[model samples]
Target: MNGAGCGSCHSAPGVWPEGEVGPSLDSFAQQTLIAGRLPNRADILADYVRNAPKYVPQSGMPAMPLTEEEARDVAAYLYTLGRR
Candidate 1:
């Protein structure tokens, strides 16, 4: 998947180049919420990955073209980041 594009808006330990548009994802796995609103879970993350605007209409994230499976895969990968 092209989750690398996400690095342009959110910073993660291995994803580059770091961005300032969104919050850093270095500790995403430890977060209690997604976008500070929805519960931080696989399903929610996958949905957000597919279409963030659906959950947060005002979200700056644009809808992605990834398939459901691809979005879920990206979410799973994101959950591996910043594991203590």
Candidate 2:
């Protein structure tokens, strides 16, 4: 789910150019917050990923509408991306 969707824009080896569209998740685990406001907790980020549209109507990000389980899985995957 998230792998297919987000991976389209964020694969490895320069697939996703670093810029304003969205920050790379490679270092997301180290970040203190998402979008510079929301805390960078796994659950919070998962919720945001599941329902980005509700929080920011004008955001270009599309809503994924993931189930709680899916969100948790994806968030777990993301958290593993840049772990030290």
Each model's lDDT: 0.83, 0.69
Stretches > 4 Å off in candidate 2: 1-4, 12-21
Q: How far off is model 2, as Cα RMSD?
A: 3.3
> Candidate 2's residue-wise lDDT over 1-84, tens digit each?
434366554443333443345556676667787767788888788888888776677766677867889888877877776678
Clashing pairs in 2: none
Model 1, 1-84: lDDT tens per residue? 335387778777767778879888777899999988999989889989889999999989878888888898888888888878
Q: Give per-model TM-scores.
A: 0.88, 0.73
Candidate with best TM-score: 1
Instruction: List pairs with backbone clashes in candidate 1.
Output: none
